[model samples]
Target: MTQQTLQRPSGWIERSRPAVQWTALIGLSLGFGAVLFWLGVPAAMLIGPLLAGIVISGNGGKLRLSRHAFVPVQGIIGCMIARMLPSSTGGELGIHWPVFAAGVLSVIVASGILGWVLVRMRVLPGTTALWGVSPGAATVMTLMAEAFGADAQLVAVMQYLRVLMVAAIASVLAKVVGANPHHAVAAVTWFPAIAWLPFAKTLALAVLGPLLGQRLRIPMGPMLVTLVAGVVLVHHGWLSIELPRWLPAIAYAFVGWRIGLRFTRPLLAHAARALPRIIACSLALIVVCGAIGAVLVAVAGVDPLTAYLATSPGGADSVAIIAASSNVDVRFVMAMQMARFLAVLAIGPATARFLARRATANANAAAAAAASSTDS
Candidate 1:
């Protein structure tokens, strides 16, 4: 009843605000994700939470998922990708190595060119444009963007924008080409049968790998370290990785929240201004990659659908889903996608760095020239 009691209630309300906001955000994300999943959208869980996060941030919500939590989540994602890329694809690669090489190189180059154009046109600043257009898995590229000094928020926008566009286009293409993808991809059971020993081992690797990487202060360390270890373990048959469905969903949600909750009004405005250019660049990359697919059809003697699916610029898992349903050579499609992923992981960093430096130097030069002319 006194002043102190009134102050205590106000403080308690302030303290509880974040909890309440997070609850609403989570509920909204799950609802969004559920709808997208029903529609068979690829990466629906991540995208749903991301959209929900953006909406929350826009509405003046103030809460962030901690970096401590986000880092381990990245490691989990890396482990997921490692397990997803099949080791058995090596045989297909051996047989069609030339075609696969061409397809991979073509897509990477096409994406890089588009990214550079975006930078040149000032559509997006610096290496954000480059990383955004990089043809790796959208989530992986989004996670790695901040480490490489790109705007992770804008990159997330660009990467996921492309993911949705590419997935929608691929679905339409699959349908037009007479591929019935209905029930092609199986729904993941919420609680699948578990191998506890392997699951525990995988979990330990996901948690510890990132800790080690962070301790060593490696850039993008968490995901890279876990990815390397996972590839080694899985390739050598030293370990069989197992993860529950919910763990990844949680990871994706947290990452979504982390990226989403950071948006400012100004940045949102900048994103809006850049949206049309982003769309055009994304479409250009898609069309170029489709042309590469056409090359594969002609030279590799693969079907048009297989060729298109193989050379799809991003969203390897999504492409895999479509491939599973079609009459395409599943092994060949997977091998191509895996090879491109590996190539991106290997070459993407150096490419991004080089392009970033180039972009920086050019901007510096332009500014200097303007100053010199003004002085003269």
Candidate 2:
């Protein structure tokens, strides 16, 4: 191949197409973030980009992101999780362990049963329902749902919808009671550092994690492997890594873009029909969790805010982000949220299997009934 043939000339408009799309994506994300922040919705970094991507997708623009594209993002999240711990379990949690543990378990069981019901009713596919209504563990659940024959785009929409709702509810409740609620996306305002060291470490880990996990046939391979490595390394003092503040937004933007790209008219219509019911059910779950929080407040002598944060159906990252600036007890909130996240992680596969079986049974029974009617 000659040099000229190999390096063909590019037109200005053609070259600008890629740049224009990316610029639009970035602009939309920032606008969404700013608006969500102004409106006091928590976790704007993730939610904003997600909604932006949906808008772009709805408008017929093509912006696709894959889980593999988000490997670095997941790695950053994993590292953040492992590194943000207070270096101790904190003795205060011991006082309310039983109550908090019960609260966490309640979220899992309640959401899982809801997932089961949704699946049996054919509201969502079995695997989609399993992870879509899950209370926490966003990265793991999304990956697992995709692995189990679910629609990743739908899972992202449903999952992030719930996350945003939970954040919205929390923000509303915070304002109702005269509390100064924290802005979870405030981390975005931090200046980006010369983060090459952390970036280098994260790059190596991100590259290695999926490869190893896939080799071992582990589920949600990249997230699980990277997260586990981060936890182990952080706890053992082998690696000290801190991601740049802006990186998380990029990660979320990519996932959102990819998800939005999948939104054709049919999917949007389905989502429009389904989202109200899903949002209503999610609010109900939050209410149930609030009752548990009330019980914790009464019995454990913790404040209502602390109890609420502990029992909130939101994921660890958002909860942690909000907890950072709130008057609530961070230790207790994290302890409870982490407990539920881990519990869901452990029990999710089993629940998914059960849902799949139930779905199969329902289909078989329906088919048999149809055959009998046909004979009649």
Candidate 3:
């Protein structure tokens, strides 16, 4: 037979590519998410997709969810937070400015202490330890760690581990404290009302939010942008809408997937070795935050559920999801999270650098002492 006649069809392979990718993405994310959701995992949509992303992407296949997809997802979440924040549905999240301020400061201080402890114990590199334990701004810390001489991958691993731990722990805690998120959404009948106009309006604003955020140089542009617009519109009484609950679930999944996809084989190995330390560090932060949360309970007059959600170490989107379902004050929780997030962004780098230097000096001194003893 002629060589050309015997050649396998490259066209078939090309045609199969997209189909294969879609099957993997849908099957893995949905399969995992559905099972976990049924099992009563908090933010199951996010967690399931996140875990699946790690498994699928980590293996050999690639899922083709576009980066641009995050914009609307974030926007949807933002609107939801704004819509539910001041609603009359949940418990009164007393806005105790003084206690809230104290809580924010406490979270930062506690995280810094843990970061130093990590450095001292050699749990992680200096910069990585510092930024990893910072209270908020995981994405920012991961992105900026390299500039401050931290291993970006290691920082990401640490940050994400804590995030995963916090989400898991906090979800359980929310239930124990009577902040049942499912019940929180039970009354919100605006969801599942899928229509074109409202969705389009939401999308337009969501799309515009990012464009404006890009122009304004806002960190975490899409979320903050749509978020600000939503809040502003709500107060002015110019905008009113509710998004399909499914969109936010997708957003959560995307967020988790984004973090999970970064876990490369070598990075996974490093993370595995450091898993115990990472878990310990994460638990330490939660303990400290929990203590501070107690103070918030007494001083703020806010329910335990709201206080805990506000002080939890995860990002705003995470807090909001739990808050929305648990009947915590979504607005108050967002405010606290955003404050901590911004605070970490501003001070985390400097603190990390200082701690990194201290770590190096300590290592050098220890090595010198060992050398002197050996020489003698």
Candidate 4:
């Protein structure tokens, strides 16, 4: 009998140590922290990096301008809207079913239109474009789109880019309107060091949730899991973690930086050919959705502007932040936005794929007919 000996190769373990993984993590954390510090002194609400990293690496890019640019703008908008809402829930126009319905309808229409535009312009595959334009949870939309055969990477890029854009734009608008916004509530400073016990639990859930989601083949993976886990923890009172005051702003800045980096010459050249149609469709979608939202607001007897912002196909977090800052019924707007997002996350990709397939079939049929006629 002969015995065989197997020798391990050198540096095999080192080589397998997760390529370029730390780059995004370290960069996101440091960048977010720096932004937070610049916004204020020693604000511990620095979890922006965790969220931003999810957005950056999720798209296989370190950063992109489109995604990074929108976050702060959206945050400012969210803050302004939040201010508009009644400090106490016992106001004349309470959060009701009508408000919810209007918000949901607005998001659905806006997101659908945006998706269609992207598909027609070929900036992204139809399915991916649909999910990318959705104003709901980006991670959730990404996962669902993947299940429906959408391009996950493209969806991640689009969703994050929208967030960055919305955030940036909203912030500017808020500033213009003379709205004073609160920094993101720092997680560390809000309750004390021991407050993290609940956050740790929520984080554990976030980690486990993503793993489970991935095993289930969820699209946006960890990001969606973390969002859902955070919401649930908050709702359940098991975790009372507050975001740092500058967290949203800093997070958004990181998102903007990432998105801005995507503007390379080649990408821009491709966009140039397609940008007109894409912009047209996107604008059309926004108008239609905005109209719908305005009508709903009127019917619900709520402030039209808040409804408009909530229903806008921008981004949930951005809208949430706007609603928060502007006193615009943050819960209602955020809830509706989340709902619409869920709908898009669930159905947008399937709808886009269906449309794409139909277009392809029609083109093929037309080509076949032309050939037959020539032969005849």
Candidate 5:
């Protein structure tokens, strides 16, 4: 009877372990997210939960966010992106295709050069550096990094770090140039009056899109499928994607935690040591992108503010917010941003692979020369 009592208690504790861990994970995510939001950090909702997951994982938390939850979250994020890019933006691009093409190419080439430099310097190991500085959507790049054999954790660090820095510089510059705060888009209410039919349609897309994408075996299939379909549907006025604030918050938190929880102590330590170099690379990229923006101002005959926001090496969503709050041409800013995003998506993977191979070859030749010298 005594033995049975002890065993039963042990079993009970074992069963309760997951529940306890989950509770802690949720609590930490919310707390960190709130603080970051208060601090006006860009992507705070995503970064907060990521930081929380890092803390949990560092302290031996074993629980993870499931793939089932993650794929749909990607769909929601895809929808969020679609909402920002309007059909008018495409028309704007059509008007100034040459200028837009040149600007986008310049930014991408600059990013590639920086990425190659990182590989040559051995800042981050392998082709991870290439993926890190792809100049694409930060979240999408991070999500796709693992599939390409890059270290997703390190890529996340580089991508988000660059994002935070770029957003900060853009915001301060906007304020300095007298951007009108009143022009900012209205904040969405979390529990707004729901249009059930439209909301249901959105839910349906979010669920079915990913499933079909996975079945098709496309790279980052879920997100790509949802992004394409959402854009087409919304652009045509055939669908209205109604995502309340809380819905996206939940999605961001899930993606963040999924990445963050996989971090090990060694990985965290490595990231800490590489922090300074990472910061330098991020700043350098921003400066280079700023140079690109200046070129746009001179050649495209646009205002400095519009040029800067248009060529900013940050997330489109963050840049959009800054552009909207300013007196700049919002359509032009978004158009340029979208054009660059599409360009990156089309060419980023192949370029990253090519540059990575070159970096590796260069490293190998250098190592061989060093060995020959040592033998002599």
Candidate 6:
């Protein structure tokens, strides 16, 4: 009958709201699955929830469009554009130091600038903005954000959304210019060899990445782990892994559903005040990065569009899809995409720590001033 006893039970009930959580989880899963089915695997590369997150997070408008609806439309447009890029181009654009340096520089500079703007505006916390604008894999950002105590979900969503938008726009432009986007040719089937080495390596890397992410406080643990492992496997010739036909679609759907779920009125209100700045900063970064990437492509004597897609801040899968469809070197595109992703993932936590430290120092200074005034 005591007041404390009554309050404790109510708090426990609220915490144990299994029904609501389950509903959200199941709804998200199904919604994501449906999006994959609707868009088809190849098209879904840009249709995922992460892509939706960008639009949702960057939405400055009053009207609320369901991410579910928007992602598919975007994907369709992206796919159409991807279908227009050349299926094969001359080999003049081989990877080299200058090209690599340009890509790296663009990503770093753009990501830093966008992160600084977002944090200064207070639309999002510094760490969250850094992770969100890191221009890496969505999963990497998420894991790093979690380790750094930023809102991982928000960062992941926003980063993915930007990827979708960029991919869609890029693809469309490529097609409009009369590029030849070709479908992937079916590979010769090899009998499944019972190779334990590849599977074991992949599993080990996956586990290790998360552990390192936890210890080092990296974001998007699973993604970082898988990407690193995948690269190692490919490099060692232990695995000739290609993304499954269904994966891009599935990834996009899950991303889209996750984004849609965050579309509540209250969150929208908060995003409104700072949405314009966030969008402007992100767009500026993209344009600058794209221009640098274009220069690198021209210097390397490679197709400009391929280089642009590779260095673009869009998701790796989407870029890969565009590369594959357009006859660009899939391996080269994936390699660069992975490199960019790793760069963003690795830097996110460090950037966050630095910003957080500065913020803490300022707060401490303010507190000291307040105490001195009180004494006076």
Best by TM-score: 3
How close is each model in CA RMSD to the real structure? 7.2, 8.1, 5.9, 10.4, 6.8, 10.4
> How many collisions per candidate?
0, 1, 3, 67, 0, 26
lDDT of each: 0.74, 0.66, 0.71, 0.52, 0.74, 0.54
For 221-303, candidate 3 gives per-residue lDDT tens digits of 77787877876776667667557777777777777777566655456766777677777777888788888888888876777
Best by lDDT: 5
On TM-score, who's better, 1 or 2?
2
Q: Residue 356: error of model 2 in Å?
A: 7.4
Steric clash count of candidate 5: 0
> What's the TM-score of every candidate structure?
0.64, 0.65, 0.83, 0.55, 0.69, 0.54
Error of 6 at 241 (Å): 9.3
* Ten-residue region with minimum lDDT total, candidate 3: 87-96
Tally clashing residue pairs in candidate 4.
Answer: 67
Which residue pairs in candidate 3 have backbone atoms (N, alpha carbon, C) closer than 3 angstroms, thus clashing? 179-326, 181-325, 181-326
Sorted by TM-score (best first), the order is 3, 5, 2, 1, 4, 6
Which candidate would rank higher by lDDT, 2 or 4? Answer: 2
lDDT string, candidate 4, 48-110, tens digits: 453445444444443334532342333333332332334343242254655665567656656
Off by over 4 Å in 4: 1-95, 98-102, 109-165, 176-178, 181-249, 261-266, 373-376
Tens digits of per-residue lDDT for model 5, 206-297: 88888998899765678668867887899888899988778888877876676577675555666887778778778888888889889888
Candidate 6 local accuracy as lDDT?
Answer: 0.54
Residue 231: error of model 3 in Å? 2.2
| Better model by lDDT: candidate 2 vs candidate 6 | 2
